[model samples]
Structures are given as structure tokens and as C-alpha cells.
Target chain A: MLDNLQLLFVWAPVMNVQMILDGVFVGAVFALSAYGLALVWGVMNVKNLAQGDFVIMGGYIAYALFHPLHGMGLPTWVIIPILIVVAMAMMFVFGHIVYQLIIKRVIDQDMFTSLLATFGLSLLMQQVINLIFGPEVQIIDSELPILTAFDSFVTIPTVKIVSLVMAMALAVVVVIFMKTSRTGQAIRATAQDPRAARVLGIDTDRVYAFTFSLNAAICGAAGVLVSMIWVIQPFYGIVYSVRSFCDGGGAGQFAGGDRDGVRPRSY
Target chain B: MKFKSLKTMVVSAAVVASVSMAGSAMAKVEGDTITLGSSISLTGKYATNGLHTTRGYDYAIKVINEAGGVKVGGKTYKLAVKYYDDESTPARGAQLAERLIQQDGVEFMLGPYSSGMTKAIAPVSEKFGVPMVEAEGASRSLFTQGYKYLFAVLSTSEQYLSTTIELAAQTTDNPSEIKVAMAFENDPFSLDVREGVVDAAKKYGMKIVIDDKLPADLSDMSATLTKVKALRPDVLIVSGHSKGAATAARQLEEMKVSVPIIGMTHCEAAKIQEKFPKAAQGIMCATQWVEGIPKRDSMFGSASDWNEGFKAEYPSYSSVPYQSAQASAAVLVWKEAFEAANSFDKDAVRDAISAIEMETFYGDIKFSAAGNNIAKPMFMRQIDANGNYNLVVTADDMQFPRKAGY
Candidate 1:
């Protein structure tokens, strides 16, 4: 460990830049998923343990698209962003169905009940994914050339840069949507109090469904980035769920509210 | 509508529970069939190699059954394995072994995948006094346990990639000045492989550089590669299972971290050459058996013949993995032992397995007192530009200073 510290600090200090680049690439993925978790937990008050599974599910969609589609003589850069959008739209619909079938019932129950329900959903999604995709470690190779710096010591894949920009762009779009859109206002109103929003003529059920679906869409976008950069398998979801909660809780605390009321306002 | 959905879920859960209970109550031997139980890594981290080992067992079973089956006590008995997914965890492996013996009523046993898995199942099989011949799981510590009921058909893990260190020493003019970097998984199999490398490196008075224990998931190691860039070691050796090989090959290429000699175990099992042909070129891969091993039997013909048959069965493979070859060989050992014993008695089969000395397409299968296949020697093969593996026996056979095109 000491030798490693010395090697990084003394022998090859330039490698520090390479390590940080790797962190930024992975961090972008975590941030997107975290934002999704913050949205759902803040709005619906549903402790979604299956949030990570949504990310992995979205990654599978990208894998199904980018892998076979690219083989049919299509370019990667053109297909990647399009697949991300496609995954988000598909997951939004899936989340709506799930909300109707499962989440809608649990919303009236206590937080513990919602936790148990989502935990079961997480397990169900994992096994279903294993059956569909098999238990192999899959990656959607973007085939984009890597850029190098400082005499090739600091290497960066072009896909990671694209994923970072995509993540930032998605974040900006979400912030703007939450701030100005009429549906976004209803979502915040419902999050503050469903009874109050209902009295004000906002359909609380519709607002809850929209908020949950939006969170899934954001997670789907993060998952597309994961496919381009790292490897994904069925059982790797639990790790992502943990990170999402961490980022969500951290973001919540930083905004100074019980359930991050200030951040949910800017959701 | 909600009531109907909940009712459907409840009924499905009941059906699944009942089906699983029925699945465990299979017979050991019934109506001209001999059942051997095995807990394989059908899911989890080791799933890739587990599938290869399963194919090996299944393909061999098919060949043996077609070739008049195993003739024991004047009755021909078809061989079938009752497999349970151990999920690449030791605790699960042990539980499945007990369940295979107790609930499944399996008298004879086939080995699970990997040394860690075998270590877990061995104790359970030994307690039940069931004779087990395993193809995977090559840790030397397994052989030291004095397991009379256990027999392994593959060379120990210590011999897995130690040959690369010797080759490195031979290729270098200054053997004493050789530098070695190792990244082994924190599992029993890889840890033993690391010990063998440390011994080999010591003989040449080599300097030990970066040594990292990869997590069980074997997910990310870009940090290790970053260290490799700064240190620039003469030799880089890695061993973890198939996932480890995939992660290493993926990151090594992505980072463009090149070394003169880089050796990794399970490259064939992972199909690194086929998946990432450019990055995998010139990388040395260790194997238990190859097509050109110059061995044959009437059952499987020659090593090349077995290779052809396996590729025919699983046509997706560009090259056959040694894991499958050794797995098929383990099944052959069971057939031989069952015939030699001429009885369905567990102790008779155990004695038969211990006294066995046979030759097949996978190579010579003879067990030592400790129950490891001391007859076979592990070989190192270099993946060529076209993704074909060519056996590299000596230092000169290697393409020095690996050029993994960044």
C-alpha cells in the first residue's frame, strides 16, 4: 500500500489524472441514478430497493440495441444517443405499468410495506434478467477510439466523454422540466402533500405515476451510459442501488430539508 | 382486479414450491441409469467457466451413452448427472452437495467448478463417503486433505501460470533482474496460483512489484492498470477465473498498458481471443489440455477428434476450453470406476477410483495418494492474430514485448 502511494505521488504523479478521469466517468453514472432515487423517494415516498434493477434493465435495452444494430452496418455514435432516448421512453412506460400494478397499492401503506414490496420486485427483476440475458457479463462496446494525453499515460475512452456530456445534458433537462413544466409543478405539489394537491384540483394519482415514471426514465439514461463504459450482469444491481441511495441521501441533506423539499422543488 | 392478481401470485408461488420439492427427490440409480450428482456454478461470478464445465460433462455423457453406455455387473447403465446450481459461492456449494447426497439420493458424485467450490463440496462428499471425480478445482491444498473419496483429473492451481515466470526468466538475459507484477483474485484457486508464481519468481531472484487482490466480483481494475503504467513491470500475471480474464483483457487494452510478458489463466474459458481478438493477440494463456497433446482413446478418439466433436456440439466456440475437456475426462473416470467396481456400492466405487490408471483424449488420468492428477502438465498457448491458440513450449515461442494496439 505504501509502495502504491509512493508510485502515485512520486514515481508517476501524472497517473493521478488518469485515476480521476476513471472516477469522473463512473461518478457520472452514480449521479444520474442518484438523481432518479431522489425524485422517487421525495415525491412518492416509496423506498424503491429495485431502483438499481431499473438501471440494469435500461442497460440491457441498450445492449440489445447497440450490439446487434451496430453489426447490421449502423454507426455507434448515431445509435447510442438514440438508444438512450429509446430506453428512457420504454422504461417510463414500464414504470407506469408497475406503478399501476404494484406501487399504487403500496403508497397508502407504511414505508416498511413499500420497502418489502420493492425488495421483492428487485429479486423478481434479477431472476427475470438472468433468464432473459443469461448469467454472462455483458458490455455494449461503443467501438469509439480512446483519446490519450501526457504521452499515453492518461487514456480516456471517447464513449466515457460522450456519457459524461449526456449525463450533464440529461441533468440540465430534468432540472428545467421540474422548474417550469405544469406537470412538474403538480408533482412538487403532490410531494408536499397529496391531500393539499388533491384539494387544488391536481390529480394526486397521476402526479405520483408521472414522478415515478420520470425517475425510471432518468435511471434508464444512466444505465445506457453504464453499457457503453463498464460491464453489466443481472446480480450487479444491488451495488448500484446502494450508491443511488447514498447519492440521494447526500443530495437531500445538502439541500437542507426533511426529505429534501428544497431539492424536490428544483426536481 | 387487484384481488385476482394477488391470487395468481399466491398460486404461482405454491406451484414453484411444490415443483422444487419434487425436483430434489430423484433416484440414485433406476432402470439402467446411474446418477451422479454435482453442484456446478450455473450462476454468479464463475458462471462462464461453469457453463463450459457443464458442456464438458453433458457432451461426454452423450458420447458414452451412444457408445454402448457403461457396462457394469453385466447390465449396461446410461450415465446422467443431477446438477444443482451452487451460484459460485462456497456455502451454496456445500449445501447443494449435502442436498444432492441426502435429498436427491445421489450415490456417486462429480466435482463442482473451481478450487474454492471444490474445497466447499469436498468436505460434504467426504462426510457422506461418496466417491467424487472432479475436473475443475486444482488448488494444491485440496490434495493435502487426505480425501480418499475425492479424485481430481486436472493439475493443481500452483502449476497454472508458474510456467510463465520460468519463460520470463529464460527469455531475459539478466534473470535476476526480472520484475514481476501479479493481480490474483482473493479466492482459494487464485491464491494458490499466486504462491506458485512467488516460488517461481524467487528461484530467478526476481523483484516483486505490484500485487493486488481482486474482489470476488472481479469487476473493475483500472486502478491496478494505472499502477502498471507507472511501474512498467517486465512481467504481468493475472489469475481469477473467466470474469477476471475478461476484466483484465478489457482494461489492459483500454489503458494501453503493455508489458514484455503478460500471462493470464482462463483466457480460453473466457474466450478473450474471440471477444477481443486485437487486445488478446500475443497474450499467453494457460491450459490443462490442448488439441495437439498427442493422446487418444477408442471412446473419444484423439485430442483433436474430441476437439472436433465438442466444437460440433457447441458450434459457437472458436476454440474448445480445457475446462470442458477436463470435465468430460472426469465423467470418463466415473464410468471406468463404476465398471471396475462392478457394483453400485459407494465404497467399491471409491476403491475403483483410487486404483484407476487410464488414458483418454484429455490425456493420462492417474491419481496420486492425495488424489490429484499428477500425470498431466499444464501448457501455455499464445493467441495469434487470427484468434487461434498456438502452443508455446519455450521462451523463444513467445512474441516478445506484447504490442496490444492502443
Candidate 2:
């Protein structure tokens, strides 16, 4: 019986299944953070240096809603959606302000200015978060039990499961909105060729504003997903930003003699 | 007329040279004030540890100075400390060590807290012929380097963990056969501790039920604890820092896992109890300093008195990190050696430091033949039911198990 049990453990097919699921759970968060970076690159042809900071900001909002606001009868599950909406709205406003005040001036300049400007914005945002939250790490939780099977061969944290589902749903919504929305189409056209897009009925200035806002919204969604599994801190933004840059997945060139707004690596 | 004026000029030059030479000697003591250099990490990820250690040095210096420093060779001299922050990087640590020896001219050196940084700086000690009193680093290879200059104050990680395991074996119903689980960070100190535990466990015919590396930035340990619970080991040995230990304990408590956590050097900090008040209780860790050790052998007044003094001085600082206490003891060593040598000669002070065997605030300390500091005395401390750590076993205690981990 002992020999049989040992053999059974060694030959367990369920072990492979568990490892794959664990990898998937870990990969989903990575994909979600990347998607946000991709979206902004896809829309504006301007890589937001502060993308990571926006993610961290979204996390803080989620944490505040889940823990502190939960005392006022708000359910934990519902807090994530509210956090997403608030993060999106705030980021949208921030994007508009940043573009009109800073980005518009350097839209025609070399990539160095936009890169440096965005990086400076990122650092400033990180410091601001640090001042407000202090340096200690914080997390969002619904106090759920961990899910496991096969005598601990397969382990799944409930937070990761929920985050995976939420991230996928958000990604789908963003994709659909870009395809069907009137403003998204004009932004796409403007991303392709600002001069040609201007000759068409598209307002290039308005497209830039819309594109920046869309990127912020996507970032806000990613932040909501991140807070579910990982502890968030102000310093975390730089790491996420570097990872996004390294992956180079979102923006590129299109056939219409225009820059594809989704070209993540090019800009 | 020309001869007279030339003689006068030569006499004036002679007088000026003699006066300047006298001034230089007066400013620097030959052997009285022992000059020791430290290449410690004072600002970086390890800064929090270094900041508290600086206090320990100050406290030790204050007491020694108040007592008129070390008395040796019929003259007394104060201890002089020269320190440079390495920023917790190995390259920086080596550079600082080189500077301390070549530029500052420290007779003897004190090692840093982390093993990797200490190893990086180890060559400087050999090159300069300045003996190093290693207090915090526990890498056996450091002491085993065969260099006459390197002397370790604290016991190696393996020795401590092995002793703890021996103690646990005594408590178990089956002395010869036991199931053990090991969890530690993938760092040098913890890795050494893990290796020692595994070796001892195997030697004692104990089965290792589980062994895994906890991620460095791991905030949640519930998933890991569940694995431990399933393993159902008779003992769970956790090798990590305060945060990691507390998190492990917290998760074990939440999961209703009942195995006792045998901790590494990381859990010795007072902040562990404050961080995980309930979970920290009953966990055991080994250290060179303990607040509950009997006052006669310890250097810092009484253990409790020293602890109280630290609390009063820096209320925000966590309970004493053992490395800080080691730094305190190092200052006393420097004072004693300087007094013994009575000259600032590096060779003389190095010899004096090697000869020192005294009862300091930490306990009885002396350097071994290899120049590794033998001053560090071990104590087995346990966080009690009230979440307070008390010295359960001292080196002097007859009941204290000495062969590692009991």
C-alpha cells in the first residue's frame, strides 16, 4: 500500500493541471497591466511615462473603497466596480489636463521630450501617492478562503480567480468600445495620419484628447485587477512601467500611410 | 656677516619642524584611542537595521568613555570609530573597506550585516593585514577563508539551526525519528540555515516532509501554510527575516496550523512581536543577545535595563535587532584593544584585539586562533504566551542544549 501510494504521487496527472492553472493565474495579472500600456500606445502614439503610477493610483482607490468604505455598508464585491469607475473618471480628467497643458506643446517634437515629460509625470505622481498613503504596503481583500484540491497539489487563491475574470471582462469591454464607438474611430484615423485625418472630417485635437482619456481608463481597469491579489505601494509604478516598455506589444504602423494608434513599441 | 645670518635661518627652520612634529603626535594617540573602521550599510534597504546599530555603537561608546575607556599598558585611551555606508551593495562595501584601510588607517575592522557584502569586503582585510571582527554575517566560508585576519563573532547559521533542531528532538516523543518541514528565503543566510537543518535532520534520521523557498516580496503566506498543514510535520523550521517570520506565523494561526515555528536570525528583532502580536507568541529563535539573559554575564547593564534604555532613547525604533547589539559589543572590543596596544600601530592593535577576552554587555567574548571573534554567546529565546520574548536558555545554563538547535 505504501509503495502504491508513493507511485501514485509520482505519476499524478493532476499535478500538471495544477501547475498550468497557477501559471495562468499569475500570467493574467501580467497581461492585464500590459493591456493598459498597450491601449494608451494604441490610441495616442504617445507612451504615457506615468502609466505605472496610474496603475498604483487605481490600486489605492480600490484599497480605500474595499477597506475603509466597507464600514459604511458597501459590499466587498461591489467595491471593485465602483473603484474601476472612479479610477477611470479621475484618470480621464487627468489625461485631458496633461495633454492640453503639456502634451499638445510637444506633440510634434522628438520622442525624447514625450518620454522625459511622461517619466517626470510618473515620478511626480509616485511622490504624491507616497505623501498621501505613506510608505507601508496595503492590499484589497474580501476575506475569502483559498481554493485547493488533490491534497494541496492544486492551490488557487480566490482573489486571483476573481481578478482573472474581472480583467478579461474589462478587456472585452474596452475592445468592443474601440471598435463600435464614433470617437474611437476618429482617434484611430488621427493616429494613422494627422494631416490626412484633418482633411477628412476628423478633429485631430479632439482625437488626441479622446485617445489619452481612453488609455487612462484602461489603466484604471488594470489597477482594479491588480489590487485583488498583490500588495500595492507607490514604488511599484516604476517596475510596472519598465515591464510594459520591455514587452512592447501595443502600438504599431498601419497600411493607410498612418501610425497605428495601437503601436505599443514604436512610440 | 654672511655665516651669522645663514646660521640664524637654519635654527629657525629647525625650531619650526620640531614644533609641527610635536603637534601631529599630540593630536593622534599611538595606542590609546583604538581606531576601528566599519564598512556597514547605513543607507539603503538595510538602512533600518544600520540606523539601530549606530545607536548600539553610541551606547557602548558612551559607557566605555564614562568609565575612562580601556586601561592597558599603564595608559587609557578612548575608542575612535570611522564608518562608511556601503548602501547594501557588495561593490560599495568593498570600496569602503579599501578606503577605511588605505586612507582612514583603521587598525582593525568590523564586518557588515549581510553575508554577500561582507564577502565582497573580505579581501580588503587580508590585503591590509587588519584583523576583522565579524559580528553579523554568518557565512561559514568567511571564517573558513583560511586568512589569519578574518574572525567571526557570531556562530554560523548551520550551527544555530542545528542546535535548535537538537532541542526540538528532545521535546518530541520519538527522539530518533521525526518529520520536519523547512521554509526560508533564497538568500545566503537563510540558505545556510536551511542546509544545516537538512543535514542535522538527516543525521538524526528525521524525514524532511516539505522544503520550499518563500518569495522575497511575499506578503501573504496562507497558501504556503496550507501546504505545511497538509505535510503535518512534527516541527516547522522557518528561515527568514522579521516580516517573513511574522507572515508565516500569521498564516499558520489563520489556517489553524499547530506546528511550532523554529525561526532563523531574522525573527530575533523586537518588531516581530509588535508586527504579529498574537502569531509571534511561542515561536523560537536563536541570537547572540537577549534581554532576559542574566545580568552578570551581559554587557548592557542588565538585559532588561539595556532594552529599557533603547526604548526610552528611540521610542519609534523597534526592539533591539541582535546585529545592533553585536555592534555595541564591537565598540567595547575596540576600546579594550586600543588600551592594550598603547600605540596606533595597526599590527600592535590587531594583536591586542586578538588577545582580548572580557565580559562585555553581550557576554564573554574573545578572538579565536583564526581571528574570528569568539565573543558572540548564544541564547535560545522564545516568544511567550503573552507575546513577549524571554531568554529560555543561556550559554551558561546547564540545561541549555549546546550541540545545535535544541
Best model per lDDT: 1
Off by over 4 Å in 2: A1-25, A39-263, B1-37, B42-48, B51-55, B58-85, B100-108, B173-176, B214-230, B242-265, B268-272, B277-282, B295-299, B375-377, B390-406
Off by over 4 Å in 1: A110-112, A251-267, B1-26
RMSD of 2: 9.0
Worst 10 residues of 1 chain A by lDDT: A258-267
lDDT by residue for model 2 (A33-61), tens: 66666655655556777887777887887
Which residue pairs show backbone clashes in model 1? Answer: B138-B157
Q: With candidate 1 superimposed using the best TM-score fit, by how many Å does residue A67's alpha carbon deviate from the native?
A: 3.6
Q: What DockQ does predicted model 1 obtain?
A: 0.53
Predicted structure 2: clash tally: 35
